[model samples]
Target chain A: MNLVGSFFGSSIGRKIIMALTGVILIGFVVGHLVGNLQIFQHPDHINGYAQFLHQLGPLLWVARIGLIAAALLHIWAATVLTLENKRARGGDYGFKHTIQATFASRAMRWTGVIVLAFLVYHLAHFTLGVVQTETFKETAPLNHYVMQNDYRVAGFTVVKAGTDVANVHSMVILGFQHKVVALFYIVAVGLLSLHLLHGFNSLFQSLGLRNAKWSWLLHKAALALCVVYFLGNLAIPGAVLAGKLRPQTAKVAATAQR
Target chain B: MTLRVWRQAGPKALGQFKDYAAKDLNSNMSFLEMLDVVNDELTLKGEVPIAFAHDCREGICGTCSLTINGKPHGPGKGIATCQTYMRSFHDGDIIVVEPFRAAAFPLIKDLVVDRTSFDKIMQAGGFITARAGSAPEANAAPVPKGVSDLAMDAAQCIGCGACVAACKNASAMLFVSAKVGHLGLLPQGQAERDRRVLAMVHTMDEEGFGNCTNQYECSAACPKTISHDFIARMNRDYLGATLRSAFQPEAASSDGGGA
Candidate 1:
């Protein structure tokens, strides 16, 4: 076998793959959360941000493909390793007891499966526009232009034409406006938090980065990161359900008029 | 006291727990000695005695392995089954004992498992290929105190396979790590260190041992109190060895043109 193939076939090699893919996925999730948080900003800011991404065109496709590949590799490695672990256990013990393993560590596989299922639902709901929420509304592309002039002069502001917006801001707000959809997202993100809680430290260990000197710090960092992700993600749905976020129709109309 | 023990007549026989009552067990008796007392009674009654493996009765031999009440070597830290005393248990408590369970170590009968797979792993590379010569002076090749201490710590593994019994994954990474770290830290073991780690790890995988999930259960269950740090050390060594071997051909070819 080729060197790469042989390395990947080994247990440590597979673990390394899981770690690398996990890092990539974590980056993507963090980036996604950041962009989603823009819902709290002005409508023009988020819609323009979406337009900026849409203008990236091919670069956007590259990122999408890379994320899909990383997700697949992560799931593949996890399934294979979990199966191997199960087989190694031979049979059930008469009476089993856990000594040091945490609840998050024990629930890793189940949380991973839940997060994966949520990923599919999330993509279908927002990205594919397939699983429409109760508050779903079809939005048309709007031409965006910058009117940069002295704010003191109301009508004398200069309008510069820009690219069209995809109305992603409206989609996010309306999607989360549905109580059931928002509740589902809250639950899924909670599972994702659990998965990340155990996975970050596990990733370090799998990649041989864990040692007695750094294990304590690494575990604390992992827990902190999980909490950040959980709270950040949970905030969006919480904001939407509480009627704190609203569609930026007035701003969009003003931009169109300008 | 009520004793619940696993009973399997043969390698393929169905296993089950059989209960036996002990009337006069001294609290000062070690757990294995209590088992021996129970066996003596059974033999006197013309019944097949409980079959368990033990030698030296001390903790060093690694021969006496049992999962007592769902714990490897019973409920204590840094002590084997032979070191556990009946005093640790309440008088009316029911003590459950079973063989160490793992796909790699199959049950032979009762609490005895065929741990010869560990022997196979050891044979693969667990030794230094040294020349038989007169013993050299102790200080001829002095090792740093920290390195020697680490080596000694790793070398304490008795290969009892308690780590496998305690692990949810039944991973033997701790055992392989101890073997690899013990030798790799010594000067005499340097010549074949790379090959030793590669061969030992390959054999461990082939023996149907699971992958390490960094759960630390193996270290917790270890009779010798071996640390999980050795596993990480071995992981780093394995990566280095694999990469070095991968680039060895280019390195060899480049060496010919150097001079």
Candidate 2:
């Protein structure tokens, strides 16, 4: 493995991993954003959506694990390849720069790290319920609630209801409602967009599909997708904070035994 | 007029740019011809003249390599330094000349870096491995004219380090692509096509050349105006070869060393 390590670390190797894995991750990101966008449709729609994912049983967990593994592999390879790239130039100066490449291609490593940080914070605040502060506030008021011949404290807010003890929806709302946190989300999404723009173009280059005519157009498509995802995700928190969004209400139904 | 030129005593020695004043130089002389005049004066004074590389004074051979006034092969498209005329510069112009400064092309003396990695890449490409039999009639191998023309066009790459020098990342993709395409164009070179691309690209990485981010400086600085389109072709070939190798899982790896 050590002997042939150089062969695997070449530009060609980097391109192969980048292209094959890039398409997979892009598909996942698009689907994930679309799924996340379900919040605007109806209030209880998100809960039902979450329930559908939960009902997948072991397959849901399998998908989660697979995503994490793929993300890690992609990041790891990118970091190694970037380091190798830096080491190749023996500290020299030149007046003329390569004019064909774009800024996104240049800042891929930095943007990638920022996106990784966003992912970790996102998972922690929403999935782990580590920081359940004053953000997840109750909007609906009720004097008392009766359920199954028993009285219980009830609020519009969702608690940690999943198998993982995570109140993801509440966390998302709380995090976005804060002005500073919302700003961070906006910036992070911007950086992510930049990363994706270059990444999408370079993905084609790595795949050896550098057709001059259509390559730029592909870059545009990638940029548009990134913007759509960013804006779509950003709108949820922005609307929630603006008081335009409220907790979804469920209608009571008569049971057969009633 | 004095020109400040980068002079490296040897590979492992500390080097600096030295200025030499030529009191009188012919305005009609070629840039390199002026250098010869300087060398003659230095020899008369029992001093070592500045060393650089040049062969065919014509523009065809890419041997006369230099970064003149910060441009590879002395500022212009489709030309080497040897082909550049002194008329391009004013008599008092302070010219700063230096050899190619790439780790992959370490300086052996004053202005010559060891560009043998190029030759090694060509060797790995198996460019000279075909059987020496009777020449097949040109019509028998009537490749599509477009492919044949493009292949012939790419075959014009002279193994010069200008592309590496001009690249900000010091990528050697342009040079390697030319080699990969030279063989990949014809049917005779088809047998080892997969192996050739894989080997040459691997050697490029091992030699510490940077990745091709599709920065077209290599093409711009090329004396032959070698199109970056060839790079795209090389990349496609490399990916196809790698995928084929993966599916077949054969012992198809080649054992060759660098230039």
Candidate 3:
């Protein structure tokens, strides 16, 4: 069999697919968290950053395509492996017990499915501006007000104004201001983190990297990183809900009232 | 002591737990010894004895298979079913005994399953092909101590299906990895190391075994207490072997030294 055919045809090879794509997906998650962290900065900073991403044009599309492909392959491999595992076991034991498997390890597929759903809703809410249509900050009165903010890039002498940029800062703030939306984001990312708890360490074993000397550190690192990642995800929505974060338009309106 | 033992007339027969209570028991007796006494009473009443598989009554020979109270090879650490003694439990305790479960090891009778699947996997490439006639000089190879120790650890696998019985996925990766790692780590094993992993793993899949999810349950249940590191080693070997095979001819020279 060819590389593709061989990988897809066997049990171990399919798992290799999962580990390989898992690496890509993990990289994307870390990069995404770092980017989204900018929401804590001045509204103009996040808005300008969104504008800069748009300016990437085809490069952004390339990344999107790669991420989408990785996601698809990861899910596909997981589905195939799950079915094979079930079938391979044949009959259920009268009394089954878990020894070393963590609750997080057992619940990987459930969390993964929900995370995928959250990803879709998130993209619609933020990327496509389709969900929560009224809250979409790309149009109307909210966009006009927020556009008054100007972004100052760190190294540049001149300010890059947000006059033409969409108010991503306000959009995120408004969306998360709704208690339900903020809570859902927290819960979704919570599950994603739980999924990563097992997945992060498991990838090494799948790729044949785990060994006696490194196993302890790998497990500890997986636990630590997953916690940090979830906290980073929790912070944005948490801050928005707490009123620490406000759109530029809201900030401007508050200043005018004074 | 009271025992809740699984009883099935045949492979296709519906099996259920049948209670056997023996007031005259010895805590010093091995788990199988207690069963032997129970069988004696059953024979007096013309009742068919509870069926189980055993050999060597040892911790080493992996033939003795049972899941006692939901644990493979009973509760004792690093021991087989035959090594599990009745002393592990209190007198009058009702021990739940059942056959090792896996699709690959089909139930043949009450507690016996056809474990020939393991045999088939091992037959694929578990042995090194070197010489048939005489023992070679030990000094000629001069194997490294660390490498030999690692090989010895992998070689300790007793072809037991306890790992499969214990895994949520029923994965045979532990066994296959041990088999692969044992030979692959040695000089004699390198000649067919790549082919060994590929063939054994392929046969394992063909026999309807699952993939390892790194749960470490297999190692936990392993009678030998084999480390899970061998699975990762085998995974590396298998990946390298697959990529190499993809690039080269199927029947590449086995010399490993050939460029």
TM, every model:
0.91, 0.79, 0.94
Give the top-scoring candidate (lDDT).
Answer: 3
- When summed lDDT is taken over every stretch of 10 residues in candidate 1 chain A, the lowest stretch is A144-153
Alpha carbon lDDT of each predicted model: 0.83, 0.71, 0.86
- For A73-118, candidate 1 gives per-residue lDDT tens digits of 9999888888999999897788778878889888888999999899
Best by DockQ: 3
Between candidates 1 and 3, the one scoring higher on DockQ is 3
Lowest lDDT block of 10, candidate 3 chain A: A249-258
Q: List the residue pairs that clash in candidate 1.
A: none
Q: Ranking under TM-score, best-scoring first?
A: 3, 1, 2
Output the better candidate (2/3) by lDDT.
3
Residue A61's lDDT within candidate 2 is 89
* lDDT (C-alpha) at residue A61 in model 3: 97
TM-score, predicted candidate 1 vs. hidden true structure: 0.91
State the DockQ, from 0 to 1, for candidate 1: 0.58
